[model samples]
Each structure stands twice: as structure tokens, then as C-alpha cells.
Target: MVIMKKMWKNNQARRSVSQLLMAVVAILLLGYLSSFVYFRLDLTADKRYTLSEPTRSLLKDLDKQVFIRVYLEGDMPIGLKRMRRSIKEMLDEMRVVAGSRLAYDFVNPSEEKDARLRQEFHNSLMEKGLKPVDVVESKQEGGTDTRRVFPGVIIHYGSKNIAVNLLSNNPVLSSEENLNQSLQALEYKLMHAISSLVADTVKKVAFVEGHGELGYLDVLDITDELARYYEVYRGFIDTQSPNLDEYAVVIVARPTGKFTEEEKFILDQYIMNGGKVLWLIDAVTVNRDSLSTGETTLALVNETNLEDMLFRYGARVNPVLFKDLQCALIPVNTAPAGEQPRFVPAPWPYYPLLAPRKDHPITRNLNFIKAEYSGTIDTVGTSQAVRKTVLLVSSRYARLVRVPSFISLRQIDEKPVQEEYNQSFQTVSLLMEGKFQSVFTHRMTGKYALPPGKTFREQSLPTAMIVVADGDLIRNEVRGRGSNPHPLPLGYDRYMQQTFGNKDFLMNAVNYLTDDAGLMPLRVRELRLLLLDRARIMESGTFWKTCNLVAPVLLVVLFGVLVNIIRKRKYGRPEKFG
Candidate 1:
């Protein structure tokens, strides 16, 4: 009986060993296959882990290795830690498709042992255009600790490098929402840089000159920014030959002079051929220089000659100035005329802080756009083919001052009456898309004919254009006089010491207009923040902690006791019964 029992035990042990060996072999096979076959299941409700189609396309076509150095490592706030994990997950998913073509490493700038070396490293990053954010954390034992954190990345593709600041500092949004916005924009920003850097043939964009458009100096900052992604040019429209075939996009920024018939025809034909245009026009003319002298300026109708052309296309910039209670502040001399001028900052109604349309990708989550002597935009034209979207509008308390009117600094003293400023939500910026009917469709005479071989298209190929009623939206402030002058960043207010969203809006507009890969739509992705209730945690801190600490151990103990009882019932029973 003892010998028979020993043999039975050995047979049972051999079966157990065989099952274990098979399980090990299956695991090994799975690990080997996983190396070649990469797949991840994104069970997220928002699909936040999944890469957009455009981004995947961009990555799949990368001929050269793109190395990214992310500086978001080390000790950070819980929000930043979450962002860091997200960045890693995003890069991991990207690497699944890109293989070795995409590589990234997290770097903690504060990891340096020496203080001076760390400072130098931070400075180098700043020079490369990576903005460093100062974070203050409260200690458990005492006061707050301050540290400069760089939530940015430097991407290198071949010989060129691009710096991208990952954090979005929208003053209007709370910190959590701002971080969420930054995370939402990560794919767009990274793919934009990659697309710009990996392109073998760089596309060209032109700033149309010849008409009294904003000068090179006035648009220096924006020009520099756009140069990173496009071959930027400044030249007069070729009225004689009238061919803009080489340029992908053309910008007509705040042209004070009139557009000639030939010039308008060229622009119209260019759009007809699937080209993009950004039109920043002011219908009313104001001597902005006169305001600096603390005097009233005559706001007259500035005849740019393109009004009729634009009206026919889809939009009209009215001959008026927009005034909003939600406006920017300007320095006003509070002291009497003779006394030492006490220039105090006061709300300037003419400088309307236009609200961005939340629905559109171009202006989504953008800060208030600052405009000087802006005019209202009216969507005209009933063509179903042409789609017009209002991208920017004035606040609830907006008033339109008619042209041939006086705009005086003395008006600051008079309190704004709620009844007078009744015009609410006036459109100041518009985006027109789809196949635009040519303005010169029926009116194209021999003078408007293109140079040989090219036929005039009465209807445009599917294209887009943005018309902003404010010209000064693209203009930056110059600090010094003449030769030594330095231009501040676009949307920066010197008096307020704050930068508005003008630059971002323009960049977004240009990006949307020129986006061929359909990358702009990815900007619309949103991740809902499911935050833990702080009050509940504070109230039941110890209770939850005890549950978290003891529940798992109790579960394991109960599972072990159940397993032991099953073993006793099956194997410890009397052999005589069997």
C-alpha cells in the first residue's frame, strides 16, 4: 500500500511539472511575439492615450531619427507628475510606430550637484526658447520651497532643433485647466514641430507688401516665429504678371492703402487655386499716433479699396471703431494739465479685449485678444457654398463708434452708461472656408485676365481664409527710436506687463489655414479632469488610510484560508473513502 501511494504521488507531481513547463513556454512565446507585434488598448473614454491619425502619419513617414529631450523629470506637483506620466505614455505609443526613429529621455535640470552649473543649464534652455516656470511648494514641516521648473522639450531632427514649451499659461483658466489644456495640445505641438523639421521641401508664405501694410519692423516678432516653419517673404503683389503660384499662403496685414483692380484679381485667382490667405484689415482709419499726444483723433473711413472685394467674398469690415467695457488699460494723466503729469492706467474702450470663439480650433481656449482701434466684422453674402464662422467677438457691453467721429482721451472721465453700450457679441474676426465664389466671377473683364495658360476659376478649390477687422492685432510695440529700436513680442502690453493671446491667435490662424495634413483638428481633443474631492479626503483621511492599508492584507489572508480549506477537503481526506 505504501509503494502504491508513493507511485501515485510521483505521477501527480509529474503532471504538475508538465503544466508548469507549458505555462512557462507560453509566456516566453508571448514575450517574443510582443517585441515585433506592438499593440495597445486605449480603454479611456476620451481616447486620450491614442495618437491622432495625422500624428501617426507624420511619425510613420519619418526618414530620419527625431530625438526629444523632455525636461519634466524629478520632484514636481501631483499635476505635473500626472503630465509627466502622460508624456511618457504618449511617447511610448509613438515609439510603437516610429521604432528607433523617435527617441526621448526625461531630464531633470535640477539634478546637477553644483548650483552654478544648474543655473547655467537653465540659462541655456532659456536661450533655446524653453520657458522655465517657477513653482512654489509648501513643506510638511515649515515654509514653502521655490524652484524653477522647465515644462518644455527640445526636439532635434538632423541638423536643426526646435524648442517647445509644453505648459499653457492661460491666465483665465485655473492651474488644473491650464495643465489639461497643455496636455490636450501636446500631440499638435509635437507633430507640428516634427512636420516642420522633417519636410524636405519647405513651403513658402508671403506677407503682401506695396499697399501700406504693416512694415517689417512692426511685424518682426511674428515674422521670426513663422520663419521657423515656413520660408517667409515680403514683396509687392505682381500686378503685371500676377502669379502667386509659389506661395502657399499670403498675408495682407493692416493695409492702409487701396488694393488695385489687378492686385485684387491676383489675390482672387490665387484663392481659386486652393491657396490660403490671412486678411487683417481695418475699415476705419485713426491716427494712432495722435492718441500718444493726449489728444482726440479723427476716426475716418480708410478706403482700402478691397472692401467691395471682401463684401462679395463673404465679410465686410464696417467703417467704425469698436468700444468694449471689457478692454485693455491705457495710461491717462490724472493730474491737472499744468501739474506734474500723474499718468495712471485706466480702461481704454477703443482697445477692446476681444473674446475668442471657444468652438473653433483657432481660438479655442485662447486668452483675450488685444486690438487697437478695431472695427466690427459683418458676414455678408448668402452663398451656401461659402461657410463663414465668427472667430472673435466683443463682450456684452460693446458699442460701435461711427466713422467721421472724434476719439478723445478725455472720454475716459465719463462713466460708460449700460444703456448706450447695448451692442453685444459683435464679430471682429471671421473664418471663411469651403469653396469660395470668386468676387470677380461675373465682373472679370480683360483687365482682370490672368497671364496666358491659366484660366480664371469662377469658383475656388476647397480653401480657407481668416478676416480680422483689426489691423493693429499683428503690430508689435517698438521700444527705441529709429535704427536702435527693439520690437517687443506680439500681444505684449508694456504698461500692463502682460502678454495677450494675439500671437497665439495669429499662429493658430496661419496653422489652420496651411494645415494640409489635417493636424489642426487634433487641437479639439479634450480630456476631462476627474479630480478627487479634497474635502472628503481631509474629512476621512485616517479612515481611508486605514482601509487602504488593512483591506488588501485581509483579502489576501481570507484568500489563503479558503485555498487551505480546499486543499484539506480534496487531498487531506481519508484514502479509504476513495
Candidate 2:
């Protein structure tokens, strides 16, 4: 009897030791996991995330202390409320990512709109050099309107401020894949925008002038936003051309007059000096100054021959009109005198809203480059020459019209089938990167001074973009002044009630051309992936069955079996699990 009692005591001691060991291991394992996870999964899929690297870096190097006053209070739009949660998630991520390098304070501007608080926000905008975007009172539910003020985010590094505009019309949210891609890009965009604003190296982009090019007002109206990122300047290279090396990139936008040999030579020299050019040229004359079309009219085909300069580089802009069945409709035939409209504007055949390719940094997030009177661009590959990529294209059924006479918006029709129509796709926009011979290398013209640089020809010139298709959609169709958008870009369908993508497109292109840091501009992220195969929905039954009936029964059976095993183990019976 005494021996039996001693055996029981020994077993009890062993069991207690094992339980203690298990508890200690559980605690250590959990501690290790908690270190890696700083932020919780609190954001919704409808929102996003990013960090301001400039503010972060400055806090470490310059030791600058910054403050941000977010004017969001009261109730948020349901969508915006979800966004607020996402913003918190992103802010937490930034805090963890920056560690001791940054500190910030989030504030509510509705605190009585007090003089001190209002003054603080205004002072921050001025002192930090941030752009101040006004918030408009818009219509809400219940026959009432509400006044709300907010922007995407703001970063203050030293005295420089980088304000990010998040709310824009996004057409891509139509596709889940596209939305995922864009979110991926958002991270890098936030990083680069903030960093570039604070970086020591300032980039200069000059608009080439004196050849009847589009004036600064034409683009600066839009590029004033650009001036914030690049040093915008007016540049010309006649015989009186100044130092071409002053700029990192030169812009040539719709230069109507012919280029004098000397003038062309100076530009050629600039390219040889490692300067990049963003050539937004049009082969066909588009009457953007016409009436009824908001000064925009489309026409086609010319041999005013720019190929002499471009062909040597392996890409040529053809003066052919691109027509397609898949096109935007403009009202052609309206409702008769007192009847519902019987005829709608048939696709204008030529204004092929060139669909952007899913690949490539520039056109990846780019959609329907809303251009009118666009021309076909031909790319001919060569050896010991530059590389070319088609950033935009029309549908496979697209037709090209050759010029015999002037064609108006009403002259569009289906073209006869041709081999070119079925054979291959035509390129609308191209990228060129390689050597180029100076147009004035063989000819001496006194019109130009001894070139901007020593080189007569550029050998292996840097990469640059040449968009042959005109940016006709760039015309401010919506009539709004200040920062408030007037009418939003027409939706892809009526269901897409957001406007972020269109604005993002312009901003993304500018970022791609100037910053090409492979920051994943087109990639996006999507969490809460719930893919319910509709084919099996009926078979899976309703939520109540799946969550309550079926799940509970399975759990109860599992619990009963587990209890039985434990009970048997306590009594020293043969263990079922073992």
C-alpha cells in the first residue's frame, strides 16, 4: 500500500512539471510574434496606405519638428469614414517605420474654429510652404448639404511642405485587379513625392519656346502643380540659346512652325549633353481653338515630314487617322422635335480613345488617353539603335484613314477591309533611347551659335518619351476655378461614382517621366480577399446554415470526441487520439 501511494505522488509531480514547462513556452512564443506585428488589421479594402519619407529623413538629419492639423471632425462620409480608419493604419505604419526619426500630432479643426486653431492651420500651410486646398460644401442626403474640409495627406520637412491630394476620380476601381495594382503604386508615390520635395537635388524642366509652341499658360495652368516638383523655365535654342545643361529635361509641345536647321542643331546638342526631351507632338493639325468643340477639332494626314529627324532614330509619326468601332459617343442625332432620341452620336471613328497597355510604367495605370484627331505612329526596330515601346493602341478592329481631303466630325464611316487592318497592331505612342545624329551636322547655318555642346551627334543618348497623339482631353472641359473640380470626368459606367483615377493618371505620368525610380507606380494592394464562387453558393446554402447550423454541429461533434478522450485519459483508459 505504501509503495502504491509513492508511485501516485511521483506521477503527480511529473505532471505538474510538464504543465509549467508548457506555460513558459507559450508565453515566449507569443512574445516573439508580437514584436514583428506593430499595426493591427483595422483598415478597409476601400482605403489605402503610404509613408512620408521626406518628413522622416529630415527629422533624423535636420532634426526638424513638424505638426499636422487634419480638419476632419463630426461625422465622415461612410466611404471617408472607412478611409479615416485606413489613414490611421497608414499613420501607425509610418510611426513604426520611422521609429525615433519622426513625430506628428493629428488635430481636429472643428474645435470651435477658434482663432488660435484656425491660425495654426494657416500658419502651418505658410510656414511649411504647403498648398492650401479649400473644402467646398457639397450636397448630402436629406435635402441638405454639408461643408467638409480634407485632403489626402500633408508632409512638412524643414520649411518645405508636400501636400498630397488623395481624392480624385479613379476609373480603375472598376476592375479589382486594377485597384490592387494602383494601391501597390500608392506606397512608392507617397515615398517619392515626399522625398523629392525635400531632396537636395532639384530637377529642372524647361519648355522649349520661340517656335510657336504651346505657351506656359497652356500647360502651366496644369504644370503649376509641376513647378512644385521641378524648376519650370521657358527655354529656347536659337543662335541666342543659353546653357542647355541647365535643365534635366526639355519639353517640346506642339511646335507649329518648321525648325530652322540651326535651331534644330541647338536642340540636337542639348540631347547630346545628356538632356531628356518630352516631345508632345502632333502630325495632324488639331484645331483646339475651334468653337462648339471647346476650340478642339480633329483632322488628319500630312507629310510636313518630321521623319528626317525622327526616322534616323528608328520611330516615325505617320499622318494617318486612327479609327475604331470601340469609341466614345458624342451626341450626333438628338431626340426629334418632340420625340425621344432615335439616333445617338455614332463613334466618331477617328477619336480612338487609345486604350493603355497593362504593362509599362507610364501607360500601365494610364487609361483611355482622351485624345482627339490622333495620328498613327509607326515604330521600325533597328540595330545599334534605340529601343521603342508602344504605350497606347486601338482595338484590333481599328481602321486608319489616309488623307485625300479634309474630313470633319460628320465624315466618319467604316473602312473597307485591308491587310493592314487584320495583320498587326499599330503603335500610338513610343519611347526612344539611343544615339541620334544632329540635324545640322553636315550643314553650317549661321542662325545658331557654336552649338550648346561640343558634340555634333549624340551617341547613346538618354531615354526620353515622344507621344505623337495629342493630349486633346487635356483641355479643361470642366469649368471650375481654384482647386475645386467642376464636373467630374465622365464615368466608365454610371456606377463608378469616384474621380481619383483621372487625376492620378496625370500625376503618375509626370512622376514616371521625371522620377522613374521603379517605385511601383501601377501596382496596388487588396486585403480581405473573400472569393465566394457563385457556382457553389447555392450548394453552400445561406449564411445561417454555414455559420450556425452546419458549423455548430461539426463543432459539437468535435467537442464531444475531445471530451471523451480527456475523460478516458483521466481514468487511465486506452487513449482514442493516441
Candidate 3:
């Protein structure tokens, strides 16, 4: 009996040790597996915490360390604080994919106690291309205080660095809406900056300038903007042999004259070689200079000779002018001529404020695009291979005026009946993609002599083009009050002092055309903002405060009571031996 008891005790001890070992091994295994597998569940309705696939891929392909310095820290307004929080979250998510390759720091340049030091810091940031914004804070007592802040970031990768402005300000939008748009665009802006810095080669873009297109001074703003990402060139298409092979994209902005057969053939063959083009053409030409004299002008149809070419390629620029009820304003002289002229803002129907289509990435979430005597675009031909998307359209109350119509400034004083403005959603800009048939295919034999040793191509390689019916869409007004003429922003309205989305729209179109890695699609990621009703919040502040203060404590107490009851029931039962 003693031997049996000893053997039983030894077996019991071994079993107990085995159980302990198994528990230890399970814990170690779980710890090891967790190190390799990492994931985050985005529970927000807008998926605000989710990183885009392009961002993940970009981070995963990092070859060197990327360092970022964000100058958005310190005590500020609530909106700025929220922006700072968003930046931190985005960087944390990026770090997960980039591992140790990505590093970032939040800095407050205004933290220096000395005024001179702070100014110096601000100047340095500005020299590095960071823009400063003046923020005003309302004091609790009665007054207000102003603070200059740089809501921007500088990204450094290898030997290159790029600056990104975190705030997207649209004068037309409310402050809250602008802040929301800034937050929504954070991902695209950051990713674009990173991609630009890491690019191996700079792309080439040219502005076609032969056919009385907009002068260099008119397109100065867009030229300077595009110069940041590309090697911009200004030249006419070669008549002998227009080899556009060196350029990734060509911009034919606001051509006023017709093209010769040779020039058309060259452009056709260039498309056949897989080149992208942005056609900013006006179907109808109205003399704005005549309008300045307070006289009516006849809008005549322009014969650019490229309509047949465009029609063959699956779209046509109609020769009709569009007027929308949702239009821009211009200052008009309401006072008598003898008395000092009092300028008052009056709605100008000819200047339509086009809203972007929400479906396309190029125009999604963009503000109004200012148009002056803009024409309509019609998709033609039944080619299944070509894809057409309208990027910009008129509002619900719009009307079309045919060519040879009269335009007078006196129309501003006459208010039209809303019922008469029946036309709605006229397409002003279009994006076309696919293989295109050459307009010169049938007429290539005799009309246009082929250049020596060059064969005419009947069909084009897969390519893309953007057609905008308004030529003035790409032109910037020049302000000449000072000694030197300063070009205004692309979509700025002097009367309202507001800038529209013209610059962003054109930039997006170019980026979409040149993008090969599908990064431009990141602009489509939408993060909806939930805002509180100010009046309701103010009226029910006490009730909300009381609930917030008392609810958590009550829940904790109730949870504790329930747990105690469960614990007592689980352990208080009588023990039974098996």
C-alpha cells in the first residue's frame, strides 16, 4: 500500500508540472505570434483612421528613412487642435507600415520666449516654402488676440525635401467647412508630397503656343504652379516633324486660330504614339475688350479647324454659350454718370460658377470653377472603346445661347424669370480615355502630304485627353496697378475677393493624365465631418454636461453590482466530488 501511494503521488506531481509547462508555452506562443501580426479595426463611420492602399504601398516600398517636421503644435483654437490630432494619427498609422523608416516630430516655432528668435524661426520656415496663417482668438474678457501660425509640414527623404500646406482655405466656404475639407485632403496632400520627393525623374510638360493661345503673362500662374512638378516648356508644334515623344503631356490652352493640315497630322500621329493632351478651347469667341466700352458684342463661332478632329475622337465642343443662375458677380456702376459712380455687385449670368461632379476623382469635392462665356461639350460617336466622363456641369437653372447671340452688360440689371432658365447640368469639361481613330485616316492619301519616310497611323495607341470648352479657364487676369504687372490667382474674383477651384481643377487634370502608379485616385477618399448644431448645443449645454458627468459613474456602479452577483453565484454553489 505504501509503494502504491508513493507511485500515485509521483504521477500527480508530473501531471501538475505538465499543466504548468503547457500554460507557459501557450503564453510564449501567443506573444511570438503577436509580434509578426498587427492590425487595427477602423470603427469610425467614415473610416477616417484607415490608411489608403497607395499610402500603404508607398510606405512599404521605402528604401530610406523619411523625416517629417510639422509646425502645428502649441495651444491654439479647437479646429487647429483637431487638425493636430489628425496629423498625429496619420503619422502613427504610417509608421506601422514603414516600421523604423518613417519618423516625425511636432514643433511649435512660436515657443521661443524671445521675440527675435521667434521671428527668425518663422522666417526660416517661410524660406523653406512653408506659408504662415494669421489666427485670431477671442478673449474671454472682451478683447481679441492674434497669433501667426504655420500650419504646414516639411518632408525630408534622402537629399530632397518638400513642403506641404495642411490648411485648404476656400473663402466661399464657412470656416467649419474649410476645416473639414482640409482634414479630408490631408492624405492626398501628404502622399503627393512624398511621391514628388521620391520620384526618380521629373516629368516634362509643354504649352503649345503657335495658334494665338493665351500669352505667357496670362498663363503665368499656372505655369509657375506646374513648374513645381515638371520641366515646363513653351513652344509651337514642329511643322516639319512634330515629335512630341519627349513630353509626357502637352497643353493646348485657348488657341484662337485654326491649325494647318500638317499641324493636325503631326498632333494626330503624336496621339497615335500614346501621348496625352489637355485641350482648352473656346468654340465661340466674344470680345471682352468691346464689353469694357459698355457696348454689346456679337459672339461669333471660332473656326479652329480641330472640331472634326475632336468629333472623330468621341467628343465635340458645341458652339453655344451657357448661362447659369448660379453665377459669379461683377461690380457695376449704379450711380449717375455725373455723380461719383457707385459700384455695386451684380450677378453676371455669362460667368457661370460650375460645380464639380462628385463621381470623378478629378472633380470630387472641388469648389466652384469660374467660367466666362463657357461653351458646352457633347460626347459623339458610338465607340465602345472610348470612355467619357463629365467633370464640370452647370446648376439646375441654366440656359444655352446659340452662336451669333448678343451679350450686353445691361442684362445684369434685368432679372430673368427662373422658369425660363430651364436647361440644367450642361457639361463644360470632359475627360476621354481609350484608343482613338485618327481624323486624317481617310484623307491621309492626298490632301495632307506625309512627311518624308513617315507612315500615317490610322489608329491611336491607348491614351487620354481632357477637353475644357472655356479658354479663359486657363487665363489669369493681370493686375497692373503697381510698377510691375502681377497676375491674379487663376479663379480669383476681385469683386468678392474669393478664389475658386480653377487652379486645383487644372492641376488635378494634369496629374490624373500623367499619373501611372494610380496615386491620383487617392484624391477620391472622402471623410465626412459630423458637426454639432451651435444653437442646440448652447441651449442644452447644462443637460449634456450633467449626462456626461453622471452616466459613466452610474454605469460603473451598475457593472460592479452585476459582477459581484455573478461571482457570488459562481463560487457559492456546493462543491461536489467526482
Task: Judging by lDDT, tell me the better candidate of 2 and 3.
Answer: 3
Q: Write the per-residue lDDT of candidate 2 for residues 1-578, one digit (tens) a residue.
A: 55766677568768878998999999999989898778555354544443434434433553444333333345555444544554555556766656655455555543546778766765664444343434434566535554444535576677776766444323544434443343445455456665565567788877777777775445544466667678888867746644766777777766666776666666667776556776666777655345233233446443333457666566777766666655565544444556664555555655555666666766565556555566677776555556676766777777766654355544544454554555235677676766655555567655556544454553535655555555443332444645864543422222222332223444455566666444543243334434557778777667756687678888999999998898567645332321
Tell me how far the alpha carbon of residue 139 in candidate 1 is from the true structure, in angstroms, after superposition: 4.6
Question: Which lDDT tens digits does candidate 1 get at residues 96-210?
Answer: 8899999999999899989999999999999888999999989999999998899989999999999998899888888999999999999889898888899888889999998
Clashing pairs in 3: none
* Every candidate's lDDT: 0.89, 0.57, 0.87
After superposition, candidate 1 runs with Cα above 4 Å error: 1-38, 139-144, 448-452
- Model 3 lDDT tens row, 250-323: 99998999988888887887787788999999999999888876689999998899999899998899999988
Q: Rank the candidates by TM-score, best first.
A: 1, 3, 2
Model number with the top lDDT: 1
Question: What TM-score does structure 3 among the candidates reach?
Answer: 0.87
lDDT of 3 at 429: 93
RMSD of each: 2.5, 7.3, 5.0
TM-score of model 2 relative to the true fold? 0.72
Our tally of clashes for model 3 stands at 0
